[model samples]
Target chain A: MKYLKNAATLTFDPDRCTGCRRCVEVCPHCVFEMHDGKARITDKDRCMECGACALNCEFGAISVGSGVGCAAAIIRSMITGGEPTCDCGAASSGAKTTDCC
Target chain B: MINLSSVKKKEDCCCTPQKNKNFLARTPEITGQAVKSLSNITRERPEWVTGILNTRSGLVPIVTTEWTRTDRIGQIRSRLGGYRMNYSVRPGLYAVGAPDSSSDVFISANYKLSFDILRRALRGISGWILVLDTRGINVWCAAGKGTFGTDELARRILGVNLAGLVSHRRIIVPQLGAAGVRASVIKKQTGFHVHFGPVDAKDIQAYIRAGYHATPEMREIGFTILRRLVLVPIELNQALRKSAAAALVILIIFGLQPSGILFKSAWTGGRPFLLFCLISIITGAAITPILLPFIPVRSFALKGWLAGAAAMAPLVTLTPLGGTSALLDAAALIFFPLMSSYLALQFTGSTTFTTISGVKKELRIWLPVYIAGLAISIVIIILYKLQSWRII
Candidate 1:
C-alpha cells in the first residue's frame, strides 16, 4: 500500500548513475527505472527509504535516510533512547540487536 | 592437534549426531572453535544439523531440507508471537547436500525460519550456507536495522574462512539484504563479489538456473493476501493482550458509582463498552491489514479510523444504548474509531512498503489528534455517568 505523499527521503543523481541498473535490481518497490542509459527515480513516492538502492549502488548515485518504519519501534526508541529497533530485550541492554515481525 | 581423520570416520558411521555431543572435539582447530565452543557451552547441536561435511578448511555442519515437528511448531509459535525474539540458528557456515570447495555460497540471516526457508529452497542444490548473526531477526528487518549489514557480512565471511572453503569468489545475498550490505564495500573488504539474488528464497533455484540473474518479478516484493494474512495473528495477539488490561480499567471505571464500586453497574455498562473495544481492536489490527489496499486512504490511521467508524456505526445506533443514552453513544462512536486508528498506525511496522519518513509524518499529524479524541471521549463518558448519578 502507498504511504504519505512527499514523505520519502529518497534522492538520486543521474550524473553519477552509470546505468549499471543495480538500483533497478535491488529496489523492491520498483522505484528506480532506466531511461536514456541513466538511472532515474520514476516513482519517488514508492520509495520506502529502505536504503537498498543506495547501499547497492557503487557509483553513489542514490541516497535516503533509510530505517524501520514502525511506530512501535519509533516510540520505543524515543522512550529507551537509541536507534529505532524492534528487539525488545536488546533495546534496554545496549546490545545492537534487531528482531522481526 | 585434533585427529581430523578419526572425527570424519566416526561421523560417517552415524546418520545423525547425538544432541549435546561435541561435534568439534575431533575437528580441526581452523574450523572456528569459537562457534563450536559456544555450541558446546549450550550443550546442544541444533536439531536441523543432520551430520557434518568434511571440507578442506574444516568440518561444516550439514543441515537437511526436511522440517521436523518442532520446526513446524516453532513456525506456528513465532507466527503467534511466542518465543519470537529467541528463535535463531547459530551464525556460522553450514553445508547443505554434499557441497565441496567449488560449491556456491549463499548468505542468510541467523533467524531459524529464514535459515529453514533457505535450506528448503536448495533442496536439490549443493551449496555452502553462510548465515550472518542478525540476532534472530529476518533478513529484511535485520538489514534495515543494520544487523544483516556490511560489517557483519564482512566479519562473518572472514570468520568462516569462506575463501578456503569455496572456490568461487562470489556470494549470493538475498535482494532484501541489499538495504544494509554494500556490494562494493563487501568486495573491498573480503574480495568476494556480492550478487543479490531474488527477494524470496523460493526463487533461489530458478535464480541459480538462470545463471544468478533475477528477473524483475523475482526481485519485486509482493505483499499478497497470504503474506498479509500470515502477519495478522501476531498483530491480533498483541492488540488483544494490551486491550485486555484496558478493558479491566474500563470495567472498574464503569463500576465507580460515587457510592464505591458496584458490580451490577460494571457488568451492565462495561459489558457493552468491552464489546466495542474488541470491535475496534479487530478492525484496526485484523481488518485494516487484510483490506489495506482496498481501503480508500493512503494513511493507515485514517483508513483504520474510517473502517472502525463504519463498523461501529450500526452497533452504536441499533443497540439499546442509542435510545437510552445519547452521551454513551457519542462516546462509543468517537472512542472506537480512535482506538482503531491508533492500532492501524502500529500496523505500519508489519507492512513491507512503509518508510521511516512516512511513519514519522503520520505520527506527527495523527498522535495528538488521537490523544485529544481519547480525552474528549473519556470526558463525555464521565459526563454521562455524572448525569446518570445526578452528581452534577
Candidate 2:
C-alpha cells in the first residue's frame, strides 16, 4: 500500500465506484478509505497498483493502464502486445495471464 | 456369447486383485440366457451428438455419447466387419470414414472438454479425430500423467483399425499433450505423423486456417486475467454467504445473553460486534484477493494477518469502558486476522505465482501461529465474558 501514492499508476473515478468498496476491501495496504458514501484512496502512497481493484471493480472506475507494478508482466506484454496478468506488465492475448499482476 | 478372446490384449496389463474385482465383473458374460434388454431409449442423437457408448475397465464403463455419436453403434460395428469393440478405452476414438491420400487425422484425449473443444474446433473440416482414453481428464493433465503418452496413443490407433481407415500418415494433437507423449516413439510404432496444435481451443481456428502451422504465440500457455477471474465466483459466493451468516449469529450473541445484559447501560447493542465482523469478512474474502500481491509479506497468511491488524485500528479507539472490553479487544485482534489469513491461504489453488513448496513452507511456518492466535482469542473471549458477569 505504501508504494501506491506516488506510483500514479492507478486512478480512481469516484463517479463510477458505485460504493462497491472492492478497492477498499482488496487493498493489502489499506490504501482505500470510504468517505461520505464513496471510495477514496486515502493511503495513496501504500498502493502497489496491483489492479486487483480494477479487475474486481465490475465498473470502469479503477484504471491502471499497462503499469500495475509487476515489471516482468509489463515487459512481456510490451514484447507480445498481450494484456499483462502479473505485476510485470507484459502484453497478454486476453485478460488472463500466468503472471500475478 | 461373443468371444472376447478375439480382442487381443493391447499391451501389458496386470490382473491384480483389485483389477479383477472391478473390470472382471463388467466384461460381458454368458451365464444364463439373459435377455438383451434393449432399453427403449428412443431418443435420437442430437445433431451435436458425435458419438457415445459404454466403455470397459471404468467406474461407469460407458464411452459412447450422443454428443460424439455421429451414427448408430450397429452401423459402426457392421462397418468394421463385426469386430467387437474393446471397452477398455474409457475415452475411445472412432475413425468414421474411408481415407483419401490427404485426409487429415487428429488426436485428442477422451476428456469431454478435450473432445468437445477439438471437435468443435474442427467443425467443417473433413478429417478424422483419434481420441485416446485419458480417464475423463483433459489432454494437458492426462498427458502430464502419461495417460496420453506414446504407448497408449500407438495402441489405440492400432486397436481401432486406424491403419486401414486413413490414407494420410499424420495425426494432429494438442500441443499441451506433448509433455507426456513421446512423438518419436509414436511415429516409430504407428508410422503416423504427430503434429502438435496450439495450446488453446480458440487458436485452433487460426492454426487450421494457417495450413496447420502453429505460430509460436499460439503454442504458448496463458493464465490470463479472464481465466483466473472465472474461478472467483464460486469461492466468493460460498465464502460471503457462510461468513455473513456466521458473523450475524456471533453479533447477536454478543448483543444478547447473560439472561439480562441487554437491560444494562454499560453494554450497548451489537453494532460494535457487527462492525468488527464486517471488517473481518471484507478483509478475508474481498480485500485479500484485491491486495494479494503487495500485502507486504511473502506468505499469503501473513499478508492477511497484516490486513487484519490494520483493520483493528477503530476497535482500539472505541475501547469498552469495562475491563472485559480489554480482553474482548485482545480476543478480536487475535481471531479476526487468523480467519482472514486462513481464507487468503485457500486462494493459492487459484493463483499461479505460488509453487507447491512455497505453500508448504508458508503453512508450516504460519499455521502454528494462526492456531495459537485463535486459541488465545477464544480463551480471552471466555475470560472477558466471565469477568463481565461480576460487573453485572
Candidate 3:
C-alpha cells in the first residue's frame, strides 16, 4: 500500500553510482532500477527510507533519513524523550527482550 | 590434558586470551570422548536443542527442521498478542543436519519465529546458523532499528570465531538485513564477505541452487493476504484494550443525568456510544488492513475514516439516537470516524511500505484534525445534554 505523496527523504546521485545493482537488489519497495549501466531512482515516493540502498551502496550514491514509521513509537518518544523506538520497557532496563508493538 | 592444551593453543591464536579463558571456564568437565566432550562442556541447553555437533570452533547446538508441539503453540500465542516480546530464542551459533567446517553459514535474528522459519526452510540442508542478538525482534524490524546491524554482525562473527568454524570466507545474510548491515564494512571488519540471500527464508534453498542469485521476485517484499491476516490478531487485541477504557468513559459521561449518575440513562444513551466504539475498532484495526489495497484512499487514516463512516451510516439511521436528538447523532458520526481514523493511522508501524517521513507528514496534518473533531463532538454532546436538562 502507498502512503503520503512526495514525503520520502530518499535521494540518489547517478554520478556516484557504479551500477553494482546492490541498491536495486536490497530495496524491499523496488525504488531503484538500472538503466544504461547505471542505477536510477524509478519510484522515489515508494521508498520507505529504510536505508537498505544507502547502506549497501559502495560508491556513496544514495542517502536517506531512515527510521521506524510507527506512530505509536513516535508518540511514545514524545512522552519518554529519546529516539523513536518500539522496544517498550526493554530500553530502560537494558533487557534483551521487549513487550512492544 | 594434552588435548585440552592443544585446543587452548589453537583458540589463543584465533581469539583473545580472555575469551579463551572464559571458554575454558565454561567447559570445566571436558573429557576425551570427542562427540560427548563438546556437549558436556557446554552448559544446560534449551529444549529445542536436540543434540550437539562437534565443530572446529567448539560444540554447537543442533536444531531440527521439525516443529515441536510447544513451538506451534508459542507461534499461535504470539500471533494472538500473548507474550510477543518474550517469545525469543537465545542468540548464538546453531547447527542444522551434520554440517562440517566447509558448510555454508547462514545468518539470522534471535527472534524465535525468524530463527524457526529459517531452520524449517533448511529442512534437509546441512549448514551453520549464526544468530545475532536483536533483542528478540524479527529480522526486518531489527534491521530497521539497527540491532541486526553491521557492528553486531561483525562482533558476533569474531565472538564465535567464525573463521575457525568455516572454510570459506562467504556468509549469507538475509536480504532484508541490508537496511542496517553494510556488506562492505562487514568485509573490512570481519574478513567474511557478506552475500545477501533472498528476502524470504523459503527461497533460500532455491537461491543457493541458483548459485546464490536471487530473482527479482524473491528480493521483493510481498504483503500477501495471509501475512496481513496474521497481523490482524495483534492489532485487534491492542485496539480492544484501548476501546475498553474508552467505553468506560463513554458510559460514565452518558450516565451523568445532572442527578448524580443513573444506570437507566447509561444503559439507554451509552448503548449507541459503545456500539460506535466497537464499529470503529473493527473498521480501523481489522477491515482497513484486510482491505488495504482495495480501499480507495492512499492515506490509511482516510481509508479508515471512510470505512467507519460507511459502517456507522447504517447504525445512525437504524438506532433511536437518530430520532431523539440531531445533536447527539451528529456528535456520534463525527467522533467515531475520527477515532477510526486515528486507529488506522497507527497501522503504519505494522506495514512494510510506509516511511518515517510519510507517517510524520500524516500525523502533522491529520492529528490536529482529529483533535479538532473530537473537541467539536464533545461540545455538541454537552449542548445536547444541557438542552435536555433545560439549563440553557
Candidate 4:
C-alpha cells in the first residue's frame, strides 16, 4: 500500500451476494468473510487485486476491477490502446495495434 | 467426471520432441486402478512423474527422487526462456516419499519448477503433493490466475479420489497461493481443512519441523540481488527476440542513407543506430534487472530511465563520433531512456513490490508521456535521416 495509497477497487453488496461463499473460497488473501450468509469485506487492504474472486463469483454480486497487476498486460494495453489483456508489446502473440506511436 | 479434454496431451508439449517416448514407470506397490487413473490424466508431463504408490488412504502419483536430464534441461530453459516457458506436470495427488493416509497433503501448481522444488525439499519426508491445473503457471501466478483456486483444488481432490486415499483432512498449501484459494470455502464445500505453509518452498522443511509455525524470515519475501539477477536472462532473451527484426530493419534503413548499402555505410551510418538499439535493449533488460533494488527511484519506469541514463553517460563520454549528426545523438538520448522505461515497466508484475492498481495508475499517468517522447524522437530522427529536415 506504500505506492498504492488509493483504496482497493473491491466492492461488495450483501443484497447482491447470494452467500454462495465462492468469493470466500476463491480469495487466498481472505479479504472477504461470511456473516449471516453474506460475504463481508473483512480486510480490504489484504486484497492483492488478483481478481480471482470477481472471476469466480457466479451471481455477478461481486465487483472488483481486474487485479491481474501484470505489468506486461498493462504495458500492452497502453501500447495497443485496447483491453489490458491483449499482448501488444508483450512477448506473446496478440493483435498488434497501430497506436504504438 | 470433470471435462479433462481441456488439459493438453503429452504429444502437444512444446519442448523438443524426444522420440514420442511418453511413458510413466510405476512402482510394484501401485495398484492397477491407480496406474490407470494417472495415465488417464494427459497434461504436460514432468520427467519426475514416476508412477503411483499404494498409500494407506488410496493412490498417489509417485515422484522420482533421481533428477533426470529432462529436469536439468527444463530448469535451465525455465530460467533463461522468459515468463512464457511453462514446463508443467500433470495435476494429481503425488507421493513425495513413502507416504500413507496419515501423511501431509501439500498442494501446489502444475509449474514443474514449483513441483520440483517441493519434491526436492521433502526428500526424506513422506507426504502427498496435490498439483492443481494451473496452465503451467507457478503457485503464486496461478493463484492470481484462479487456476489454483477453491474450485480447481476441490475438483482435483475429488477427481483423484483424494478422500479415499488420505486419512488426514488437512491440506497444506503455499502461502503465496492463498490469494486464489479460500480456506473457509474449501472447509465448507469439500470438508477438507486448508493450512497455508511458509512463502518459500526452501523453508517448508523447517516450517514442518517447527510444527507449522513460520518465522518472520519465512513469511517475508525479499527482492534480493541474486533473485533479480536470475530473471535478467529471460528478460534479455525476450527483448532480443522481439528486437532482432527491428535491428535488421533499422540497419537496412540506415544503409539506405548512402548510395552504397554496403559495409562502408553500414559501419558509418546504420551500425550506429543498431548499436544504440542493442545498448537500449541490454540496458533496459540486463542492467535494469541487476540494479532494480539499487535504482534510486520509486517508479519502475523512472528507475529504468535512470539506468539507461547511467549506461548512456559512459557511451556518450567515451565515443568520439558525435559530430556527424545531431539527430542520432538526440535520438539516442530520448530513445534509450524510453526503451528502458518501457522494459522496466514489464517487471512490475513479477516484483514483490508495487500493486496492480499502482501500476494501472502509473500507466494512466506516465505512459502517454513516454509514448509521446518516443514518437517525437522517432519523427525527428526519421525526418533527418530522409534529409527532409535539419536542426536549425
Candidate 5:
C-alpha cells in the first residue's frame, strides 16, 4: 500500500557512490536505482530513512535522517513541546536498527 | 523472564561458552523451550538424526515434530505476549515435516511469532526452516535493519552445513526481505540462488504450488483497521505510563489553588479539574485510536482535537464549574484539546495510515498551534489562581 512522504531526507551523491549496489540490496522501499555503474536515488520520497543503505554504504554516498516515524514519537514531541527526536518507547525493540542490530 | 536463572546455568552444545552471551540474549527461545519442550515427540527416523553424513561445517540441529505446524499453546501465548517483546525462537536450521535433499529451504527470522506465522501458513508442507539471527526482530523489520541481509544468510548457511543437507541450491525468502538481501551478492557469496516469495505467509503454499510465482494480491501489503487496532494496546500501555507523570503534575498544580478564610480547601472543587485531565488522556490515547478510520479530517492531530472537544461536550454544557472563573474554564477548554491532539499525533508513528509528508505537514501546522494554545492556557490558569489569591 502507498504510504506518507513528508520530507526528502534521503540524498545520493554520485561522486561518492562506489556502485556496489549495496543500497539497492538494503532498501526495502526501493528508493535507489542504479544507472551508469553508480547508485542513484530514483524515488526520493519513498525513503523511510531506515539508514540501512547509509550504514552499509562503503562510500558514504547515501544519507538519510532515519528515526522512529511512528505517531508516539510525534505525540511525545507535541505533548512535551520538545524538538523532534526518537522517543519510540518500548515497542521499538521489535524493529532492529543498524546501531546494534 | 521466569526461566532466565535456570536456563542460564544449563550448558549444552547449543549453549556453548563461546555463544553464552548470544544465547543469553536469545531470551525468548529459552522461555519457549522451557515452557514447551514436547516430551511426546515422535520422529520418522530421519537419516540426519544420528549424524550420518560427515561434514566439515558445524552441526545443524533439525526440529522434526511440531515443525509441520505451530503448537496451539505457543500460538495463544504469542498472540497474548508477542507485543510485549521477548518472544523468539533459537536461530538455526530446523527440518519441518521430514525435509530432505530436495525439499525447499525456507528462510525465516528468529522471532517466535514470525516463525510460528510461516509454519502455520505452511501447514502440511515439508521444508527446511533456515532461521536468521535477527535478535528477535521479524523478517520484514530485520531486512530493513540489514540483519536479514546477504552476509547473515551466507554465514548461517555455512554455520549450519545447509549445502550438505539440501541438494537444491535455491533459498526461498519472504518478499518483504528483498530490500536487504542482494540476490546477486547471495549467489556470489554462498553459491545459492535467492528466490523472494509472497509477501504474506498464507500465500506461501500457493506460490510454491504455482512454480514460485506470486499473484498480485500476494505481493501487496496493507494496513487495515483490524491491523491498526491490534497495535493499540502496546501504545496504550506506554501512554498510560507517560500520562501518569503528566497527571501527577496536573494534580500538584490544581491542588495548589488558594483557600479563603470561610471553609478551607486545597482545591476548590478539584474533581472537575482532575476529570478534565482524564478526558484529555483517554480521548487522545484510547478513543482517537479506536475511531481513527471513522474520524474525518486532513490530519490526525485535527481528528484528535475533534475527539477531545467531543469528550468535553457534556462537561462544557451540563457542568456549572466553568461559571466560577472564565480564565480557568477557557484554559481547560484549550488544554483538553491540546492533550488529545498531542496523543493523537503519537499514533502516526505506530500506524501505516500516515505518510512522511502527511506527518511533516501536520507537525508544521499543528505543533506551533498547540504550543501557543498551551502557553496561553498555562498563563491564563496561573493568572486565575493568582487573582483568587489576591496576588495581582
Candidate 6:
C-alpha cells in the first residue's frame, strides 16, 4: 500500500520535541502522527517540504533538509546569486541544503 | 459642488461666510439636541444620498432608504426624467466646520466605504479631501486595477478645481494605492506633492496626529486570523455551487445507468457515494480554511487530501458497504480526497497565508499527485461499471 518512497528528510529528536504538536498541527501533508505523546514523522513520503512546522516550533527537536517546496523561489534565488534547491531544471540539490522543517 | 446660485448667498464659493455668519464663531447656544444627536444626524445622513438632489445620471436608477421621510420612488417621479442620482456616497467627513486656506489636502477613492472609513478617521478635524472617481471601488482594489492611478487623480483634482479651493500644494494618499499611482506624474500635472499615508484607514488618525509620518510597520501587510477568515465566505460560496453541482451530476449518472448496480445494491450503495461527495466538498471548502494554519502538512493540496482521507474513515470503518467493496471502494476513497484537496489548494489566490512562490512550489509537487489520484479513482469507477454490466 506504499504510494511514495519515504525520503525521511526530517529528523525528530523526541527528547527535545517538548510534546508540542505544532509540528503535528501545521504539516499540510499529515506527515506527523502522535506516538506516545510525542510527534513522529509517520508519513514522510507525503511531505512536500514546506518548513512551516520548523519555523513555528519552539523546541529544537524537529528539523528538515532546508528546501522550500517552491520551484519559483529556487529559480529566482538561482538567478540572483543564491543556489536553487527547488526541483527546477538547473537546481543544485546539494548546495542549498539546510536543517529546516 | 456648491451651487451658491440657489442658496441664500450669490457670493463666490471661495469667499468665507461673513464673520457673523460663521457657524463656528457663535456656538454658545446649545439646543435641546445634545452634541451626540447632531453627530448622529451627520452620521445617519449620507453625502451620496443627500447629493442626489443635485446630480442624477440616467445609467442607474435611484433606490430610496426607509429612513427617507417620503418614498424615494415618489421623489424620483417629481424630478425631470433626464436627471439621475447615483446614491453611492457614505458619511464621516472630517469637519468641525469648513476648512480655511491653510488646510492640507488629502485624496481618496470615491467609493462609499473608502470615503466613510477615511472621513471617520478625520473626525473633528478640518481638511480638504480630493476624492478621485474610481467608479465606486476601494483604494486598494481600484489601485490594483489602475483606476485610482495618476491619470484619474490628476483629472479629478483639475475637474474639481482644487487649486482654487486650497492654498496648500500637497495631497496625501494611502500607500496601498502606490502600486498603480505614479506620484511623479501626479505632481507634474497638479503641482501638488504626493505623500503616501498608512495602509489602514484606522491608522489615519495617528498618521495625521504624527504630522503624516508613516512607520515601517504601518506599510507591512500581515495575514492575521481575522483577515484570513473574512475572505472565507466568498471561497465557500464558490466551492458549494461548483462542487455540489459536480456531486449531483455524478449521483444522477450513477442512478440512471443499468450498469450502475451499486445504486440498488445494499452492500455498496448510492448512499456511500453521496457521503463521499459531501466529505469532498466540506473538506475542500469549509474545513480547509479554518484548519489551514493548524493542519500538519507542507502542501495545501496535501492538507486537503489528508482531511478528505480522515473524512473517508467513517465510510470504511463504520459502514457495511466497506465489507463488500473493500478493495474497490478503498481505491475510490483514496482518490476522492485528493480531488477535494487539489480544489482546496487552488484557493491560495484568495488566502493571504502563502506567498506566490510558496504556492507555486506547493502546486509543482502536489498537482501531479492530484492528477494521479483522480486518474486512479476514475479507473476504479470504470471497473465498477464493468462488474455491474457483467463485462468482467
Q: List interface RMSDs for the candidates, in order.
A: 2.8, 17.6, 2.5, 6.7, 6.6, 16.5
Clashing pairs in 1: none
Residue-wise C-alpha lDDT for candidate 3, range B141-218, written one tens digit per residue:
889888899999999999888988888999999999999899999999999998999999999999999999998899
What lDDT does the true structure give each of the candidates?
0.83, 0.54, 0.82, 0.68, 0.65, 0.55
lDDT of 4 by residue, B1-392 (tens): 11133322222222112222243223333334334444554343445756544443333456776677877777888776643344667777777766767889899888888888888878788888888878676787667656678899888877666676777788888877766787777877777887777778888889889987666567645668877777778777777888979787777666654455665665567666777778878888788778776776667778788888777756755686344666777777787777877777776666664567878877886688787887988787777767622333
lDDT of 5 at B133: 84
- In candidate 6, stretches whose alpha carbon ends up further than 4 angstroms from where it belongs are A1-101, B1-97, B259-268, B296-298, B318-324
DockQ result, candidate 4: 0.20
Candidate 3: TM-score, chain B only: 0.90
Docking class of 2: incorrect
Please write out the lDDT profile of model 3 over residues A1-101, one tens digit for every residue. Answer: 66778989988999999899899889888888889999998877788888999988999889998877888787777678877877632632665432234
lDDT winner: 1
Give the B-chain TM-score of model 2: 0.60
RMSD of 5: 9.0
Q: What is the clash tally of candidate 1?
A: 0
In model 6, what is chain B's TM-score?
Answer: 0.69
DockQ (C-alpha based) per candidate is: 0.60, 0.02, 0.60, 0.20, 0.19, 0.03
Residue-level lDDT tens digits of model 1 in B216-271: 89988978889999999988888998887989988897898888999998888888
lDDT-better candidate, 3 vs 4: 3
Alpha-carbon deviation at B82 in model 3, angstroms: 3.8
- For model 5 the local lDDT of residue B352 reads 39
Off by over 4 Å in 3: A77-82, A88-101, B1-44
Give the poorly placed runs of model 5, Cα more than 4 Å off: A1-67, A71-101, B1-83, B257-268, B318-324, B356-358
